[model samples]
Target: MSQHVLALPSPIDLAAAAFTLPLFSLVLAALIIAGTLFVPRLHNRAGGTASPTAPVTARYRPEHRALGISAIAVILVFAVENIVRGYLLNLSDIVEWWQYATPIFAAVLCLAMTLALIVLKGAHQPERPVVPTTRRTWLSFSPRAVLIGASAAFIALLGTTVAAGLASSSDDRGRFIYLEIPVPNTEIEPLRPWFYGWDFGVPVLICLAALAVVTWATLRRNAMRPYLRPETVTAERLARIQVASGAVSIATAAVLLALGGAFRFIGRSGSLSQLTIGNDDTIYDMVWKYAEFAAVARYLAPALEITGFVLLLFVAIRLLHRPTPEGHGLRPQPSAQPETVR
Candidate 1:
């Protein structure tokens, strides 16, 4: 037999390891709670009031009570899950199970997108409810179709993880597979702080713009509650869902990016001493291989989750102003096309 053999993966470890739905359920909960606590804390220090007339604080009616509560609850669970995965889980477990988190991420993304859709749907509903035999209208209104597409994407991503996992995370030159991730996994020099800005530069910009829009929309809508009078539940739900879902999406995306980096790191560093996973026959054979960087991958996963939290904190501060007597917390205002105009 050749001197080199692939380390058998951890037989004890489920090849498809990851947190169960129950864990993710908790993560979503924590993030939403963190947002709730964080906003008030940020604004309490500012003291000076913000402008209510701006579109930023235009939708704060009392009627959205239920939507707001539910969104917050869901987001909180995402937060908790990320934290536990990053802080508590072992490295081997993560690599084997990273695939599972992907679905949760997709779900969060859909939630946010749906929230936006809900807003659009309501605005267009009266004028556009279709008695249509046409394709465009049919696709647009079909919730079933939307669910099917999302499910397909989820299934596709699962396939991708399997393919990637089976293949080496390294290359011919021995860099992380596919990504050319830095080798030595940690030469430290090339992985310097300056490079982070360049790598994340474009995504950062896109995320920032999205962040601004999210903040402005939430604040403006929530602030205008009184003027709007018993806020439209749909609008309020949309706003909360947008923020909550966005929070989890950021969390999941960050963690995935971290995984990409870690894999690349293993490639560059030439260190796979950690992945010793496999059955008894492969276990001994796998030991000599020494290129199992599963631990490294695990370490990187948490970083992604952390990034999610920071983003949430940043957005919350910008939008959800603290409530006080001298506060500009939430103001309600009229929509451009009033239901009844004298």
Candidate 2:
């Protein structure tokens, strides 16, 4: 067992590339706008938690900041890598790919947060009525259905547009990788140009999941014909916010869908095994290159995806407030207290 190092190409680090503050900033701006629109409703649901830690909002707003940091991390990397490497397959300096710590970290954290949010939402049960005439507060808005629907549509359209823009770039599909694996009996099996799709998968998945929630909520709300019982509502005063939140969700899904589609086009060359260059084991040259193409998911897609992801996270946080043992379910306050009625 001998360890032999085969050399091929340089790495892609955005730090070595050109950094565009405006582009990244715009994405952040969108996230802020979207989050602002969604978080308050979440606040209402979890408002009365007995425990200070019981509130999802307590942790969520800060977590969104973390998401912003992750997006910036990717942005910085893209700037450095693309600017320095500039799509050149020089195969000399042997730059190893940058280990993306931010998104990966964000991925795990987001999962934990999302799971926590769900559990909180689920633990709630209906409150027992103390009075005869039953009444509950239904999360409501003036024109909820119409406004939310429009928002969703806008987001969807934005995603599609971005995808189209990237596709038009010189390197629309993204990057290519080549590897040299040590095979059996000293013969080397050189891997080909493949294995680097779904770079945007995390953001895409998160965004889509949020969009699904929005869709589900909208449909549920629409179905409740005459009067919406407080027990029936998952949201508290979400009608106005839903409009914006729904749009954010749709926009996220659209961008992710576009990113996936662009990757699919690049996949046309066949993802990893596109250039299977050898038969023997242990000793061959592997050439992997990151195209300096204009269409980088790290740049465009993540912004929309992450923005939507965080907003949804905020929504979930707001919707699923931490409850107390005594406050397992929310009760509609009496229409009027006994003394007041008298």
Candidate 3:
């Protein structure tokens, strides 16, 4: 097999062309504010009735408050780093530092948070006695529901991408190729097959699969009505957090899958073979002049992924430091035995 090389813009140039810090900042800020305001409200509204004797003072424990603040700080730091990196990318000749450090830092933070959650135990409150009731048939917020819905959506998006790739090609041989317009008046050529496979196929599958597995496991482990240990007042809160986090992750996966499909559509719809070249102007002249317009998803998808990751991290930290149960102070202490018998 012969290798066909299409001259394309440099990675730095593409990154600069695709993203700008100011616009990214505005979008990020809006999402953060919306999440801050709405997610908790949604949880509360969906949450069942509160106990009448629940204490009103210091709803959040000291550790919970500290974790919340730390989570917010991490998000702010990431935002600032992105803005600075975006600026540096615009000016610097090499973006190696930003490229290497940003994701590593983010990953480390998330990993550390996960480890902390697993190792650290929260203050345990006595569990209330379970009342015998008729078993419900459906649980909308169950792990099973989330897993099924997310898996279906992911498969649908994958199918859509395959269809779009086929539709975009001029030949019926089921090859995935797209045009590259690096410079005006240049020769028209198909993008490398390996590039397409790596860029379009690999990342989508990995992200979707990883997110699905993690979410399914987390939700299943913390089901709404698990057989609770005697001293676990925060069980309800933890369950709610798990559900909310899974919901957000599933939603994020859906958005990413939709964006992937859109990217494929854009590539397929703008195939060079579909257009006729005249004597004066070549295909490259017509296409490369407007390459930026066509490759919008190249930048948008990563942006969404970053946003999703940050949001998920926030949820994880929130779960790690969830407020202690109000009944923690009221649980009866174990009785002392008299020493006279001894």
Top candidate by TM-score: 3
Candidate 3 has a TM-score of 0.43
Cα lDDT computed for each candidate against the true fold: 0.36, 0.36, 0.40
- Residue 274 of model 3 has an lDDT of 33
Candidate 1, position 268, lDDT: 38
Ranked candidates, highest TM-score first: 3, 1, 2
Worst 10 residues of 2 by lDDT: 333-342
Give the candidate order by descending lDDT: 3, 2, 1
Error of 3 at 204 (Å): 3.5
**Candidate 1 local lDDT, 1-342, one digit each (tens):** 669878876855542343222343235434654655557664443222342422323442221222233234434655555567767876541222332343244334433443453354334223222232222221222234423533343333333344343433333443323322233433322211111111222233343334334433433333222223223322433344333333333333333333333333333333322222345343211121323544444444444444444443433333344344445434443533232210
lDDT of 2: 0.36
- The collision pairs in model 3 are none
Runs off by more than 4 Å, candidate 3: 1-196, 224-342
Error of 1 at 278 (Å): 16
How large an RMSD does model 1 have? 15.5
What 10-residue stretch in candidate 3 is worst by lDDT?
333-342
Error of 2 at 9 (Å): 13
